[model samples]
Target: MLNVDGKVVVLTGASSGIGEATAKVLANNGAKVVLAARREERLRDLKSNIDKQGGTAVFKVTDVTSHEEVDELASFANDTFGQIDVLINNAGIMPLSFLHEKKIAEWDQMIDVNMKGVLYGIGAVLPYMRIRKQGHIINVSSVTGHIVNKSWAVYSGTKFAVRAITEALRQEEAKNNIRTTIISPGAVVTELANIITNKEIKKGIEESMKISLPAEAIAHSILYAISQPDNTAVNEIIVRPTNQEI
Candidate 1:
């Protein structure tokens, strides 16, 4: 609908969940997708499926936490596709825990993957996008960014940082003809909850996930943002299940 045909999209965390679904949706709509994730096998499998469906795709194994690796991902996308029209920073982890629990390692992990990862993605592609004079950067946030819940202090902080970063990027890059978007999604069925070590928190997340939307819902939102005309910059999209109160 937005005429995304022939656009080149680079997506991180593309092995599963929102990243995987977004890859399929964009590719099906005629966008050339470059998938990046830590899991090489999954990336390969996803690329194969996209190709089987008559979509163009290639994959590069990457960890978004590493600035160098993220830079390489951008380079690989440019090398393979000639130019990148969009960069989707979708790789993130959600290991919700109470501060009193003293899960320092988990907190550090969240900061590294969620906050620093998004920054690294932007750093990696910003130069390229600036050079191109037309590109889009999509960062995935969460509803927790808007409202801090009981056990989501650190997680929410990370997502909130994403929103701030994307907004700043939008303001700064507008002159360069680059668009930025922050996608904040509520609970959805994904492997993000599996990383929660706190049993009580995991149980609560499981219950909430029972009524969640599929990953494709967020994928569709990403597609809509990317499909918009060059003059239209869809800055932020908040998508939640109809029954989700939060």
Candidate 2:
């Protein structure tokens, strides 16, 4: 039997892309999924699909940028499922632009969603995991986290921060028996590119995505991380399309 069977997973950013794929994959493997995202309609649709397929899932409309909402999401998941075995900090945004463009709002949004949102998720789940001395926290970073590129300064900064934070959490919580994993994915064809305000960059990204991996590729990486045994920790995974050089 898969280790993911019977685990209660709280997944954020689950309205689309990697989050959505991960939620379905885990649910199909017998996980009790708690989907979190800002779009209630999408969440409901996802839950309905999962239910139709004989997978257990529920959803909470949540904005990860707000600590209060994240807290409530954690509470709701625990209240509904009895405990949260896994928390996937998957809410993030990438509004790529040159620093010279000075798109401060986009930068702020990225920080709030990518960096602080992950922090809030960690904060919300730590107490419960610590008390149980057992849990898994999977954070979604990016290829930009390891290799910075043009127009990716702010987005890369947030992703780098994710790796840093996940590493620290791993070190700090080893005694608590909590597992931490950071998934850094390369270009996958997803809605993330739609957020780019820079038309030129967006065009280039779309062009480059001609050979990108599917969101399910990254979702399977997450499933692999979650399927590890209690004594093993698959700490980090960087998955890119075979054609992606960077």
Candidate 3:
């Protein structure tokens, strides 16, 4: 219905949550989606479901933190689909804890997966896009990037980095007909809260889950952005439930 049929889309973080949902939505709308994530089983399951629905999809086991893996996925998409029109950098991790607690490993993992992972995705696809003079890059940030909270120092920092990078990428690629879009979701129910080791923060998020929107809501927003005409780029979208305030 959105005129996105036959487009090749390479989506990271496609094993579950928003990534899985977006893969389904885009495929149903006529995109050939290449799913990538660390979980091979999950990817296979999603691929099967998409195929059963008469949608085109494939899976590549990818760890977005690994540049080699990300590059391989891009190559696979191009080889399989002939071209990749969109790269959705949706792989990220959010493990929140007080700075005072000094959970250095969790902090590092968030930085690697949330910030560097996005960079790897871009690095993998930008060259092809530049050569073709056309492509779309979608980065998933969070409202916390704009409004930080106590236990979210490192996680928020990574998201802020994503926002900044997406904006810069947009400005640099405009001349090449390459579009960059950022989706800053406030609180859609997902496994993101499972990483929060901080008891208080975990409790708060669990209680708030009652009002959080489903991952499908964010998936639809992604489809909306991707459906826009090539010349009309929707730069950024911020989605949140009506009940969520800060």
Candidate 4:
């Protein structure tokens, strides 16, 4: 076993979806998880659920768009768990729209949460990791990043930035014994689809959801990467349901 016992993990977007599942998975595997999200009730529910299953967890109300909020989340994790061994920058928003429609508000939200949010997460946790000389960061990208789609222009751009940032961080942090991994998932069934504003796009996404996957599959991939030996940095993982053509 790679032995993640008692490792403190700082997780953003922990109220639902992949972040929520990963929190549970890592805690069940003996990691002390600090959860962050904008939804207080959801975070509390997730913490309660984890506790019911005998896993350790704490939640901080956070909006990843704010640097101070992200910094506070990291500080809270350190205060609660003594040190952070991992930071999962899993917070994101996907409000898909065509360029002609010009959903500027949606575009701005995606840019803030998807791109700058990840950057804020790095800013918050990098200092602590550098000080400790050990850490792991997992950035959640999307298959849209690797392969562009019609309405996903902005979302794909953000994820591509995530992948590029993750790779750069991995190479730069290697000397410090810090590892970075980027996870790109395709069409997994989650609340992400609900964010699409275009009616036609939303309809297409709902249909695509039929061929999507369970969140646990992504959690399993995350566990697989986290459980690898320290010397082995599994830098990127892309997963999609076998039935998902895109």
Candidate that would win on TM-score: 2
Q: Write the per-residue lDDT of candidate 4 for residues 74-113, one digit (tens) a residue.
A: 9999888889888889999888899999999999999999
Per-residue lDDT tens digits for candidate 3, residues 1-246, read: 465888999999999899999999999999999999999999999999999999999999998878888999999999998888999999988778889999999998999999999999999999999999999999999999899888889999999999999999999999999999999998888899897888898998899889999999999999999899899899999999988987
TM-score of each: 0.98, 0.99, 0.98, 0.98
User: lDDT values of the candidates?
Assistant: 0.93, 0.95, 0.92, 0.89
lDDT of 1 by residue, 145-175 (tens): 9999899999999999999999999989999
Positional deviation of residue 45's Cα in model 4 after best superposition, in angstroms: 0.7
Task: Compose the digit string of candidate 2's lDDT tens values, residues 1-246.
Answer: 389999999999999999999999999999999999999999999999999999999999999999999999999999999898999999998889999999989989999999999999999999989999999999999999999988999999999999999999999999999999999999897899898988999999999889999999999999999999989999999999998888
Per TM-score, what order, best first?
2, 1, 3, 4
Backbone clash pairs for candidate 4 read none
Give me the runs in candidate 3 sitting further than 4 Å from their true place. Answer: none
- Regarding TM-score, does 1 or 2 come out ahead? 2
> Which prediction has more favorable lDDT, 3 or 4?
3
- Which parts of model 4 are misplaced by more than 4 Å? none
Question: In model 3, how large is the Cα lDDT of residue 24?
Answer: 97
RMSD of each: 0.8, 0.6, 0.8, 0.9
